[model samples]
Target: MIAIRLRSSCGAALVGVLALATSGCGLSAELDRETNPERKPTPSETRAVLPPVSATPSPSVSVQPVSGCPSSGLRFEVGRVDGAMGLRAMTLSMTNCGEQPYELNGYPSVSVLDEAGAPIPGVRTAEGTDEVPVAPPGSAPEPFTLKPGETARAGLLWRMAAEDGTYLRVAPDKKRDFVNVRPEEPLDIGPENILGTTPWAPAS
Candidate 1:
């Protein structure tokens, strides 16, 4: 009877140990799934979670001339002056902003003016020639037409002078109305009092 009871007790303890070992394996597998879930994201799910991105704006294009277009449909501007030794040169540019084509065949008519807008006396204006080069040699003026948005340029040459000029009165040609343009720097046409101008040519 004593030997039978000892065998039964041993048998019951072995069953309990086997059940605990099986349950421990299932618990370890559950913990692994919770700690490290799979990382596969669907395309729709990704789009829904991310914020929408805005597009960058493009730069604007400039169509108007440097100076505003005027009622005459032309814009006139003086380029920066270039000086060496005593010779001073600058570019005179005109842009056609009108619908009609503008004609040009000769040098622009220009005169220096005082602060009161009166023409300064004793200033000699002449056409530029090879003998008296205004700017580096460029193609001579020929009859040309500038359509809308086209530009023409001319060279102005002078030397520092005794009388300082506050403004320049310019006409596209002798026939057109004069337009007043203030030079970037005041004009100091020296004692020679000469201002030479090249004929209108297309801007290269």
Candidate 2:
């Protein structure tokens, strides 16, 4: 009876040991699953982020007529402007829109004006093409007559200055009333403040 009891106790202890070992292995596996998960496959394509587009419009030159003909019956317009090496050349034209012939003997009086039509101060006006050599040299003023529907042209030259003008106050001569003419582009005058003009000549 003593040998049989001893064997039975040993059998029970062996079974308890086996249960503990199995439980320990299950707990270890659960812990590993919690700590480290399975990895997923990587995708071949990725999305990209981009910046927002702007809504403001860029500035452009105006093509509409800015002024009407003065009582002098001559219409003045600012023509093409050419720039090179900091020098600017502009063409000024006057059309005889009246019924009779118009007399133009000399260089037209020109002054840079602000948006308010007021002359910009400190700008010097030269009557010949000597100071600014961008345009063709002008001949001395001689009395000339423009028939109706004819046009006369003058060359204006200047270095880039510090001031910008919106309008040009032009007169056929110093004695006539000034007419405002708008250029396609604003005049960008620098610190030089000097404007040179050639004498009125027949447009070829």
Candidate 3:
């Protein structure tokens, strides 16, 4: 009876040990699932977008400056200026030097002078006559450029009392300094005293 009791007690203790071992293995499996899980995908980088470009080109231009033309750049010559029956005829022509173009407008100041440096009569004159009206009348004169190798033509007509002056003087319009002039023919200053022109114009 004593031997049987010892055997029964041994069997109960062995069963208890097996149960404890099975519980420990299940706890270890739960801890491994909590510590290490499947990895998630890495985040991707964001990119910037740009605006579209146009196909057409922009336009550009250059401008030139304007300047005044003076007397020293011109040459003066004289010829016949009249086509009418009643007036003495002469034309004053100006040529610009090859150096540069000169701006000219209106009529030149003209005078006939004696050798003694006195103003001669019959050469005293006005700007217009009944035979030929002043061109571009009653307005500010437009400036015309006398280019290099180009000429500007003006008319000088008068009715004269005598051919008394030894020198003919010419100046660009309103300019005070005078250049001496020689007519194509010896001027015959008759008895008429009026002097005028058709005004100055660009030579064709």
Candidate 4:
């Protein structure tokens, strides 16, 4: 079974429930019944025919940082919510692994998924918030620049219709898409301290 991590938000849960309606398992059964309801058993039905299987291996994923961020070694952690807020948020922890100081300007993107590995529509970034800044309150907040071997924390929030698949994604900015962070990397989201928990995992 596919289990998605969720918060107490009623809105996210409502979206999850609606997603269940379009799932494949039930739809497949319904299609079978509709197509062959009046057919009688044939000799072929009694014969066991094992289909040929291929030996090719499935693709494997490795946890890697987006290209330029490797030197910064930024890591993310997510928390559970109490209910669906028109907005969803998570905290990001960034560490500077390289000798040079790093400058962090924007927040990452977040995506919610369903059991079938499809992205839940209606989820987006909240209005008026470009990206949560790392600058402190009333700090005149010069651009956030972490020194060598320094660590900083920031919050990344998004506006989503609902929370589904126990999975969430934190991605880099659009111009930085070339950073190439692997989507399957384990995030420090609360409750399992596990990695590779993407919604795209094979169905149970």
- Which candidate's TM-score is highest? 2
Q: What does candidate 4's lDDT look like per residue over 59-159, in tens digits? A: 33223433455643544444343224343434444455667665555444554443333345544442123332321111112256667656654443333
Instruction: Return the lDDT, model 3, position 57.
Output: 19
Off by over 4 Å in 4: 1-72, 80-89, 114-118, 127-142, 157-162, 177-204
Per-candidate count of clashing residue pairs (backbone under 3 Å):
4, 6, 3, 14
The runs of at least 3 residues in candidate 1 whose Cα sits more than 4 Å from the true structure, single-residue gaps closed, are 1-67, 130-139, 190-192
lDDT, residue 160, model 2: 75
Off by over 4 Å in 2: 1-70, 133-136
State the C-alpha lDDT per candidate. 0.68, 0.70, 0.55, 0.40
Between candidates 1 and 2, the one scoring higher on lDDT is 2
- In model 3, residue pairs whose N, Cα or C atoms come closer than 3 Å (at least 3 residues apart or on different chains), thus clashing, are 159-192, 160-190, 160-192
Candidate 1 scores a C-alpha RMSD against the true structure in Å of 35.0
Which one is best on lDDT? 2
lDDT of 2 by residue, 1-204 (tens): 212332344456567878999999999888767766673444678769785532222233222244554457788878756654456677788888778898889998998876565667777789986776443455687788999889988777777766467777788889988766677667876444778887888777
TM-scores of the candidates are 0.62, 0.63, 0.52, 0.38
lDDT of each residue in 132-172, candidate 3, tens digit only: 33221222345788889888776665543455544466777
